[model samples]
Target: MQWVLDHLGDISSLGLQHIWLSGVPLVLGLLISIPVGWLATRTRWLRGILITGSGLLYTIPSLALFVLMPLVLGTSILSPLNVVVAMTIYTIALLVRSVVDGLTSVPEEVARSATAMGYTPARRFFGVDLPLAVPVIAAGLRVAAVSSVSMISIASLIGVSQLGDLLVDGFNRDIAGELFAGVLASILLAIAFDVLIRLAEHTLTPWRRVQQGGGT
Candidate 1:
């Protein structure tokens, strides 16, 4: 506790960096995946290929991907871009399948009704399909958010300044307090983000609550 308070400034700063590193990728990935997922649904032949390629990206070890990103992206070994790009790739890999599943989950009868009611493809997607898919997509986002938070810690190993730095510092200096602080902060952060995502999910999908209330 004393050690944590003493290094509060360091912890806070690194924690913010960790959040930023994780968050930017999640946002970018979400934006990118929505369209890719839509396209997958629109082009049935391409769905498997798109999902398979993204899944392949996830198989590369995180640390190895981080190390390899610099050479591929022409960035410096220490550049934060490496971490951000790698994290974004992971987020997309995680979310694309969710998006596809969510969109496809819209019942065929409902889709046919929507079309019969004069809803264009785009209008039907936004008005009918997307709303129904929110719960599933939000579930994926929650998982991605927490996963990103954990993965950012690994970025510290490759020179990015994040919460994991404390673990490295603590280990090098034999300061268990510092190590504990990092681990504790990380767990709390993940929980906090998870709760926030859940709240957002509930807020966005009011019908889910209504259904639950009706069931009750």
Candidate 2:
């Protein structure tokens, strides 16, 4: 506690960097995953290939991915971009299946009704399919968000500064206070991500609230 308070400024700066490292990847991953996921849903064969391939990506060891990012991306080993890109790959790997499942969760009859009402494929996807898929997609995003926050700490091993730095430094120096601070901060950040995602899910699914209200 004393150590944390003493290093408050450094801790705060690292927390912001941690947020940037994790948050940017999450946004970029979702943007990329939506189209990829949608394309997968268009064909059975492609669906099997994309979902299976992406799932395999998540199985790669995180530290190995972090080390390999510089080689793959031609970025400096110490460059924050290496972490960002690697994290984005991970985020996409985790979320693509969720996107596919969410989109497919839409009822077939509802989709046909949208088409019969003169909705074009694009319009129907964005207007009808997406809204209905929000609940499931949001559930996936919550998992991705927490995972990102926890994983970004690994970047510190390769010299990208973030909350993980405290964990490493504390362990080496035998400073229990600093180590505890790092663990506590990481947990808090994960919880914050979960809460924000839940709030966004609630906002996007107003009908859920209405249903609960009526049932009550």
Candidate 3:
């Protein structure tokens, strides 16, 4: 505790950096993947392709992905660009399926009712479908965010500033404090992301809240 306290600045800065790197890609991923996922629903063939492709991308070893990245885009991809792209792919790969599933899971009757009410397709999607999908979608994002945080540690191997640096250095020179701080920081940061996402889910998904005695 005292050692952590003494290194508060380092912890906070490193944690914040990790958060920023993890977060931007997640947001960008959702922006792109949600639409892609939704589009996937339009065609059975495309849906299968998206699922298989994303799954394959996810299966690639992170280090190998980073290594190959430099070949495609040259030095830029090897820079911070690679970290963001690698993390974003992971984010998109995980969340796209969930977003698609959530939208598809909405009851057909409810959608028919929305259509009967003269709801525009856009209105039906935003006001009806998206609302119902929030809880499940939130779960996916939570997993992706937490996983992103955990994986950013690997970003260090690809030449990024992440908690993984501490581990690498610690292993190379046998510095226990660096390893301890890095491991501890990673755990705490992961927890913070989980809690924040759950809170967001609760706030956005009021329908999921049940009364203590079953009253509305």
State, as a TM-score between 0 and 1, how close model 2 is to the true structure.
0.97
lDDT per residue as tens, model 3, 1-216: 565678788777777888888889888988887788878876788998987787677888888877777677676643877778888988888988988888898999999999999999989988998888887888898889888888888877766777777777778888788789899888888888888878987887776676433674
Tens-place lDDT per residue, model 2, 164-205, is 999999999999989998999999999998998889889988
1 or 2, greater by TM-score: 2
| TM-score-better candidate, 2 vs 3 | 2
Q: How far is candidate 1 from the true structure (C-alpha RMSD, Å)?
A: 1.3
The model with the greatest lDDT is 2
Global lDDT of each model?
0.91, 0.92, 0.82
Order the candidates by TM-score, highest first — what do you get? 2, 1, 3
The 10-residue segment with the lowest total lDDT in model 1? 196-205
Ranking of predictions according to lDDT: 2, 1, 3
User: How far does residue 214 in candidate 2 sit from its true spot (Å)?
Assistant: 1.3
What's each prediction's TM-score?
Answer: 0.95, 0.97, 0.90
Residue pairs with backbone overlap in model 1: none
| Best of the two (1, 3) by TM-score | 1
Clashing pairs in 2: none
